[model samples]
Target: MSKQVIALAYDGRNAPSVTAKGDDALAEAILAIAREHEVPIYENAELVRLLARLELGDAIPEALYRSIAEVIAFAWYLKGKAPVGFGQRDDGDAPLLLSGPER
Candidate 1:
């Protein structure tokens, strides 16, 4: 399978931003860094594709809040960290961001 990885950074101040993205070699490199740094990595092809469409450093769009929130929640669970509210909840529902080691 081809390697597809997208890196996101959420500081609880602004919307989450896509920080990096790559395929093949660069994708492998991204995974390597995550492994070395103990960053939680979640493999979601659909999500990766959506995130890949974002320009590096662009905050995720509103339409993606719910989906991305879910990803963050899962990552937090995996790393044993609590999921925290992310920015604002458009639907007036609970939204969470993943918290873990450096993203």
Candidate 2:
């Protein structure tokens, strides 16, 4: 099977959308751009298979929300970012720091 890759974009307010998808050479290009930009990469063949069914700019189906959410959360954790209202306080922008799994 050709190596497949799917990219998703989420705005915290809406469902994640399929921003890109490709196989083989196209996949390598997409992944290279992501690496150059320091975007975290998550690998799951099954998830990619499911997401590949979506067209570009299409929001993910509700059934995949939890699975996609987990991937997004993992990416956020890898980037050291927390979603708004996540352990925030009234004082300022200080967010609660949680330990991540060992790499």
Question: Judged by lDDT, which candidate is best?
Answer: 2
Please provide TM-scores, in order, for all candidate models, with all chains considered together: 0.75, 0.82
By TM-score, the best candidate is: 2
lDDT (C-alpha, whole model) for all candidates: 0.67, 0.70
**By TM-score, how accurate is candidate 1?**
0.75
Error of 2 at 52 (Å): 0.5
**Candidate 2 residue lDDT tens string, 1-103:** 4667887778777888888778877887787887887767888877787787889889889999998878877877776677877863232222111111122
Model 2 vs. true fold: TM: 0.82
Model 1 spans with C-alpha error above 4 angstroms: 83-103
Candidate 2 to native Cα RMSD, angstroms: 7.5
Which ten contiguous residues of candidate 1 have the minimum total lDDT? 92-101
State the lDDT of candidate 1 residue by residue for 1-103, as single tens digits.
Answer: 5667788876655788877777777778877787787777776677777777788889899999998877876766666565346443332222222222222
Poorly placed runs, candidate 2 (over 4 Å): 87-103
Backbone collisions counted per model: 0, 0
